[model samples]
Target: MEYQYKEVRRELAARADTVIWLDHPFATVMTRLVRRTVRRRAGRVELWNGNQESSLWSVFTDPEHILRWGWKSYGRNRARVRALVGQVVVVRLSGQGQVERWLTGPLAAVGEERAR
Candidate 1:
């Protein structure tokens, strides 16, 4: 997770950065299904930190797949985070002046994120 975050940070700072970490290959349900099918049908192999891609059977046969987690978390967390952020003064910052104020003013001292 930290490596992914660091890659994102670096990508933002660099011009035309080819960041593999930022690329979530299984971003869509359809893509994941396709990938799983191809892997199982063709015996296409994949390894993650020395683990094989669950023979592609997990895309359906396994309930604990990442896709399941995504489905469950997306509904719950989006609303939860929205409400949680409402407790803070979420500055939907759009310009440099706001960023400047955030650094030099009380926005930084709020103990949490805040608006101008």
Candidate 2:
């Protein structure tokens, strides 16, 4: 959605009044990904298409490993979202607390405006 469908993304953003960017820290994100992966693998959680998390060793070996992807793309994703600053009304929420605040505050205001 970010690189391939430029026109479609632009149209979607233009149609929407605001975009919320969750710009969590790299360490925070990586930690969460690691923990989630561990939990999923331990539980053998089934996901879409009946897929399950692979061995923990695959984290270092597999090219398509989600943890690896997250580590590699975190900075790029942040930059990509930041680049949308001038293109849309971006509300960047840094952490869970900020997101909760947004859900209760500015987001409510947007709903109220829509109601008006």
Candidate 3:
């Protein structure tokens, strides 16, 4: 029998001290997704449990495919994260530069502490 709350993730987030969000432009995300998808399909990359991308045709035919889903959900996710600004210690990184800056700055402190 299940003993956990329905919203366990929210419960955990409430108690968490930090949440680092890797935010990127929609174009960048789409570009990455397309490249990754093409590479995986061409190479027949074995994912979890020997699963691989079945067909390139699915990219066009599958309306709920990764490419479509990512494009559609981008704006909704951005808005949701923006709403979390006051409730959590959210680090919203917009691009590679911001990500690198955080990794070398505030994030480095956390990494150094963990190494001790």
Candidate 4:
């Protein structure tokens, strides 16, 4: 639950250990290995930085089936990401304060990876 100022995005970009992926896409499929909820739903939820998650009606507009895709991969993604991000510093934070600290602390470095 750490959040860094947008300015920090630049700092992280300079770090070698940091990886930034924009316009990236993936799907979540439920399988025997990944037993999770399959809810075909989307809503216009507010996000940080004055953003909206997405309107529920958009599900029909996007061919990617954003909501359905995400619902399928709920549990599997975390495990996949953790394995993919090996050899990097991982911090499991459970609150927003930790995010504040990282933004003001060592996490300012670009390319540095920390998990919460």
> Which tens-of-lDDT digit does each residue in 1-116 have in candidate 4?
11123455345534536432111223223242123212212344444676654545666686545466665545554554354355444455434465566567864765355432
In candidate 3, what residue range of length 10 has the lowest lDDT sum?
1-10
lDDT minimum window of 10 residues, candidate 1: 16-25
Return whichever of 1 and 2 wins on lDDT: 2
Q: Model 3, 1-116: lDDT tens per residue? A: 11123456566666766667778988898999889988998999998899987587886788877788778877876776576678878878889899999889866989999999
State each model's CA lDDT, in order. 0.46, 0.81, 0.77, 0.43
Q: Count the backbone clashes (under 3 Å) in each candidate.
A: 0, 0, 0, 8
Model 4, TM vs. native: 0.34
Q: Candidate 2 at residue 5, lDDT?
A: 44
Our model 1 lands, by Cα RMSD against the true structure, at 13.9
TM-score of candidate 2 on Cα atoms, chains taken together: 0.78
Model 2's alpha-carbon lDDT is 0.81
Error of 3 at 78 (Å): 1.1
How far residue 76's Cα lies from its native spot in candidate 2, in Å, is 0.8
> Ranking under lDDT, best-scoring first?
2, 3, 1, 4
Residue ranges of candidate 2 with Cα displaced over 4 Å: 1-15, 109-116
lDDT of 3 at 97: 97
